[model samples]
Target: MESSPLSALEQRLISHLQVLYPQTDAGELARQCLSALKLDAKTPSPQPHRNIWDQRDIMLITYGDTLRWDDHPPLETLHGFVKTRLSDAISVVHLLPFFPYSSDDGFSVMDYTTVNPSVGRWRHVSALAQDFKVMGDLVINHCSSRSRWFENYKAGVEPGASYFYEADPNADLSNVVRPRTSPLLREIQTQNGIKHVWCTFSHDQIDLNFENPAVLLEFLSIIYQYLEQGIRWFRLDAVAFLWKTPGTSCINLPNTHEIIRLLRLLIEHKAEDAVIITETNIPNRENLTYFGNANEAHLIYNFSLPPLLINTLVTGSCDHLKNWLMRMPPAQQGTTYLDFVASHDGVGLRPTEGLLTEWELDNLINTMKRFGGKVSSRTLPSGDIKPYEINISLWNALSGSVAKGPDQWQFARFMCAAGIQLALEGVPALYIHSLFGTENDHDRVEHTGQLRSINRHIWNMDDLEHALNTPTHHQKVFEAMVRLLKIRRGQPAFHPNATQYVLHMGDRLFAFWRQSLDRRQSLFAIFNISDEPQSFNLAELNLIATDEWTDLVSGQKHEDLLGKVTLMPYQFLWLANKVGKLSEPN
Candidate 1:
């Protein structure tokens, strides 16, 4: 009898295994990987979505328990809220880590296969997925020390005896790149005597050893469970630090990229429509590598967008923002960027490393402090501490400008930031708090003693509904955001992979031109990033004299291609030659 030939997927898996675990039997591990994918003869055939995504696909990022009422589980409450209020505007809902955890607000996951009892059961998650696409965090880098796997390791069990990365406390870890000020090696007493395990984010979050092929199989099974529960989008949380190596920077190591490629392969094979987004909060250049020739990371968090956009709004200059935008390579066919101005965590400063100068960064940091933002620091290789992120509410962060103190243009400024975000060439994700214009929650911060708590406001559903029904700024911002998102949904020019060109209209004004893929629609998104009035000739845009143009936001017609248009302080316009109406969700 002759040996059978390896399938294409098997060949690819073996290649990845060779790269990640060279000492192991690659062929045997490949078979084990295939088994983990549950790709049996009875497996369902892949049914990919007609379009992986389009202009109408807007993702709303929120915690499972962000909104609470009575004794109802937060997931149920969140489902009711979305169905009643946001179903028309948001096509996708990203629930940030709803798993049982020991600390770090769910990022330190204790269980990968089940829902947190406090949040609700997996049925509640499936309920939301019935109406909207659901996205979940895969917390791939580390797990809570309280997890059963860690306990098994402590007991010297077979499955998890060597499941975590260990290093000598005195090793030359000086070159290790991590985003925490805590000690990297945690000394623990195991059944096999003393051991020092690596803790990248926090002592409670123990790093898993991917060098062990068994750990990879465990996560593959977890991914299968998530797919069965109606989750097609996976956010690989803190993935940049996934692979560890001694005598190296230990961040974005080659093994990390190989693992991502392997995961992408298995995921796409399991569910053709499945999307994998890598949460790599690194510098711009390093961040771009996650794309991996369109084979890895169907989407990446536009990590540099928050700090750079906020800086532009506060400093009233678009030089840095424009420069960064121009250098960004447009995402290819199978991949795009997830753009946002704010998220669950703080505005990461690491992504802005080479993009912004030291003086510019310091000025931005000072402005954030003036706006009541807290700075979180990280330990450098030389034991020096430097600011890593700015923790503050998006509403508060845009309260005023660096040139002037707190002003009366807070609402306008916030809207301007959001408007620019929506018009960019990517899928726009709005945090739940940003929708309601929530301010910094000092009470929460004081209660939790965590800097990031300032932005994670837990709202009472009753209070949120009441505020939306009233005429408060919360109501105003919520209604405005919905309207903007609705408008974006119908425009082909706003597709995540549409054509984009940075336009030069001076430093105080940021402008971009977006054209539909089929070349039918052209939109000029211009914003006055200052606290004063600004005007420019429409002729500079070179609008076609034959076709009529209209401002999508105000519905005002522009008869003369050479006419002048004035934008008030913190104002923006979505001018287009061809108009698209607000589309209803399918």
Candidate 2:
């Protein structure tokens, strides 16, 4: 007798699981996993139903200094801000690392179930989650060494207390080099004196022992609790390092993927709308795998975005941007990439390294050093320097703070970035500060003395008042972002997993189009990244519209004009044809 097709797929899946977890009940687990997948297929995936992510669907990320909720303003105050200011364009909110932690901008979780008092209480968080209909961080990858789990392991408390991944008691610390160069190490003492636990990035952030089923169950329970409170999304922090082996780099291991797949399957089965977003801050190549054929994370952060923004800014070219876009595979049937410019953490150099040549990196370093004031000398091996001034300037530029420059130039850069994010085949994530063109908070850095100190400041009503009345740089940036968001919300082509590609324009410009299969509606986004004005022939667009179309940005209307269109310096236009026409295939 031959096995059925369903049983055959189940058998193959069980065999795959056996290779990773040899001791587990593979057959039973496979049956459960299949059932879960079937259940998920019956339920609707938690995503926006429309083609474009509405401006109101934007996710405003707030961390450290920007945690205005910490001041205990009435919950209605925050709700009103979201409702009135971004009601049309913004939909979700991401509060970064509100859990208690030791260092590295709250990556070290002391307690998974509780929110840090500095931000708010669990009750407040629960209330906010209910009000906003959003979810937040689930730092299951690592925990602070001071956490109760770690302490219980150290004290040898009963009921699987010794489950933590501990270093060999006889291992020599003198020979063991620390993973990071920071001086924040705190050695844990076992029965046989001190033993060095692995703290991959920070000494205080002790990696959890995922090899233990207890740890896995504990995290699952926590997730279920948050789901009860209305958390529809969970950002799995530092997921790459969750599983480890002695010989390998211990990142992106097979077990890690399996665990993520299992967790995703379980969550989708239990709660229909909840999603798991993997925070694998790796290169594009490595980050792609986190999606796991759309079975792992529902979304992964597009780490390549920041560097692309910087590259376009410096070289005034869209070649690298085009290459990156062309290289990205379409999001698997249901999943989407969470794209953004600046995040709550520091701008990473890993993704940009492959995109930039040695000479380009050197030029970038020199430029940063020249512009960077107090923080200019800090350099990386790739020749990129963390010039504080350049960082602040770029932040200001994006936020619309520095307004005296050519409006076309500033607006061009702003619109170009926004176009890429919105037109891309994914959910575009907007950082809260980016909306208002918020600059680096130097005051917060002085207070926290951490690399991401600026991320911690909270928004004050007084500051908003001042910016609105005084017409500061941030005010203009904020207004521009709001306008772009409003326009994007009204469009239909900017939906998740839409077919997109970079247009073959000159190096100084970037262009892409998103269209439906029937060609009833379409969006064309062209950006001029260069400081000097650049032009492109509209004939190259080969759009199928016989009627005139209007430019959303300049409010200018023109006919196809024999297949020719020209763009101004740093300008971007979203031209749409209401006649249900498609562009001629390239």
Candidate 3:
């Protein structure tokens, strides 16, 4: 028999494991983890991991149970809908944690290995994978207390007994950055005795002890199992809190980044193209650290974009957004952002920390309240609570209630948000609620008594399809968005790797220019975020006076490019000199 191959991947895995789990057999555990990858040996796969994104990389973010079916599992229904409705328009489906959970929707995971019985089985995921790439959330920060591991710990089980952190109730943990106002420690009656375990998010979600090598190995096994099931895109949910060291902020700790880097390394060897997208909802500077010289995360959530975008549209000023964009680090060769306006949660306000002033941020909170949005707060080290996230659907949050204004007002503003999101220099991910043009789910919020329920609407797949196809508001945005994405994907200039130049288009207008990697295709995208009219000389944005331009959105020709073009409230334009050539046949 041939000797087991000793490759650099195995060496690196052993090194990481040795550091994290020195007491355990690092070499043996690394070998075990690598052995768990179930690649098909019958055929030579070309691309095991396709991490780099492109203009075609638009995604729909939805819970696996977002769409329901009484007769079959919801994942089956979701898979069918993606095939029928979204196969062409969107290329990826980010199915938020379909795993069994005890609380926090799907964030408090009960089992990492199996799909929730309520959602379909692994077969359903594989079915969808055949059509479009599916991005699965790996909630690595914490697990449900009701999980077997937690139960085992309560029963004095070997590895489980040492899997979680237990701290003294009186310990001073004031320096920790908390996402919620909940108490950090929870008293649990374990087999050893009654103890206070460090439960970061909630009492039910017990924080795992990454200091224990067994925990890291267990997660590695779980991740390898996911890779086996063809999940190339793994979204590390709440990754900033992955590793905890006492007497510190415990957010974005170096050990946490190291853990992420190990996972990325696993992907590099086992699944070459697998993407690790980190979700850090903290302020911008600390969040950007996940890039880690291109070895940590292939993508980090652009958390600042949602609030900043809303701020731009609400204030009719691009100063904040423009300043933020201009100062943003250019996308590295291997990494980019998963840019989004809203998600299953809400518009996070914490990300606006350094970007907006106290007054500007307060303006947003007040505006959200005026729009019937709810705010959730986080605890500070000073023991004061501050607003952290605004809970409401992106539609209601943006244009307020449709009942309050003309349909044009609502539609224009909604499309403008989408336009700016797409115009950003990253892959755009739209929440399902946004795509369906749904408003706040006040009924669900009252029924479930969960603030996030305001945005998390459950729908019957067939009903949503029929409802969104008609001339309803949902259908209007859906149709327009589809057209926009279809056009966006066909243009080479919109590639995520393209170089972007923030252009000066006065105060009310947001403009940017994108040039393709080969310099063959160039497109300038501009958005009018204000209610009032705004005009600018096309030449000001660098469209030469002699160059013939085409407005992709309107299909209008601009031969006299230097002339002024006035934008109506919330109008967006995509101008390209060689539209005929750049507009590829889809």
Candidate 4:
């Protein structure tokens, strides 16, 4: 790229960079960014419109190597599969940590710029981008110890040595919040001397020091590279662990928020449609702080929703889930929740701290165990260890079955979760495993010894094609979910940013009402959380049959009749009726 003449806006951006890095030589860095983006001597691209994420912006989150064929690079196969099987249903595909990594299933990043050879090359990524918007994982909090940056730091390399955070071995770190119970600092033999460097995740994943302008500059470079690769959606992995400072919780600090805002600013300046979603698996209120006046993240993972939704299905009650949703603060104009039922990681428990009672949590835990799910723990600030997450496939987690084969109730239970996800007030995301009704991969877990492995199975192309083609649980769930999503995509009432009202139907029923942005379309989605039948009265909510209501899910016209409305075991109904009055339409 040529170092072209700078636009005034480009000059102003450079000045801001200079202010950000007062002593460092930021002129060249700024010029490089401007050149890389090819910003002409004119106004920058229009700032991304928030309207891009509506009913149609459904996302499919998966790994590059999740599907393999004939030893071909998995990314190629992933692109082919998504392009063929999921193109119309999904618009955005989040390729989780496709870069070269050492451990933690690609979380411990060894390289940032290049794709893992085993997965495929940049062309594969570009190929997927051609079909759907591609989201890249920016493992920003820490980098692999085996990375060149870390090795350079060990050799006392000027820029790299200054990139990592270091603290005295005797320094007090009690206030530092721990995501894992691992050691906070690791003693390393550096070229300069013995050093105790901060490593919040693991010795292999050394935390980067954002306090250093050099580190921030490097990060800016990496992000620009991703932008060059056509990735517009960037998920900051384990962001709460970023920007650590002494004597603080070291999570969601003001400095951390500021850094995120700065990055958001840079991205918006270059590409308006680019997005940043923060990954913070903490309590709901604290997790939302990433929004930072709607300037920090365009989306923050609704970490609370997964566990709360799971608890609702597990206990056959909506008390916990309803209470949580009712109390949720409204999302700001440009920010919204990324609601998901399951992910590569298991169901997180930390997000349910205040939402679920100890007894309820225990009941949920034991229920998961009965279904062959494994539990992983985290160290609390109080120095006590407790279950942090439940590691299980959505299939096994819901059906309480550990058999290698499908459960009889698999499709019903899975679709119930998906319906709830779609009916929510935000952009609903589906994990690849969850979409296929995949079951536990105990063999993978035993072989890799990573509990999360049970839910992270890479499929053989032939086996996967067979499963998806036949009338197996996987095919049934996939086809049903796609059908639901298709219906959801067309309904203005299911708009991601539309206004939602939680409807309290009854003990076994969970419901929410959605109104379109234009106020011309509306829907009342109701779910039976238990196996038992549940019924309600339309008169209770001023809704009536056939005259003013139609069931969207089953296409059943609600004929005028008795006030009682009934739902079968695990059945869900979506009703569209008169927006307000229950009088006859005519």
How many clashes does each candidate structure show, in the order listed?
0, 24, 3, 2
In angstroms, the error of model 2 at 538 is 1.8
Rate residue 215 of model 3 by lDDT.
Answer: 82
Residues 81-198, candidate 1, lDDT per residue (tens digit)? 8888887798999999999999888999989888999999999999899999999999998999999999999999966788899999888999998899999999999999999999
**Stretches of candidate 4 above 4 Å error?**
1-49, 400-408, 544-548, 577-586
- Top candidate, metric TM-score: 1
**Lowest summed lDDT window (length 10), candidate 1:** 41-50
What ordering of candidates by TM-score runs from best to worst?
A: 1, 3, 4, 2
The lDDT leader among the candidates is 1
Cα misplacement distance, residue 385 of candidate 1 (Å):
0.3
Q: List ranges where model 2 is wrong by over 4 Å.
A: 1-20, 24-56, 64-77, 158-160, 168-180, 183-186, 369-412, 563-566, 579-586
Q: What is the C-alpha lDDT profile of model 3 across 269-329, one tens digit per residue? A: 6666678899999999988999998888888889999999887877778899998999899
User: Which regions in candidate 3 have their CA more than 4 angstroms from the true location?
Assistant: 1-6, 22-25, 36-51, 400-408, 544-547, 580-586
Output the worst ten-in-a-row residue range by lDDT, candidate 4. 577-586
Q: Which portions of model 1 miss their true places by more than 4 Å? A: 40-51
Question: Per-residue alpha-carbon lDDT of model 4 for 172-265, expressed as tens digits?
Answer: 7788887777778899999999998888877899999887866776777788888888899999988888877688888888667767876776
Structural RMSD, model 1? 1.7
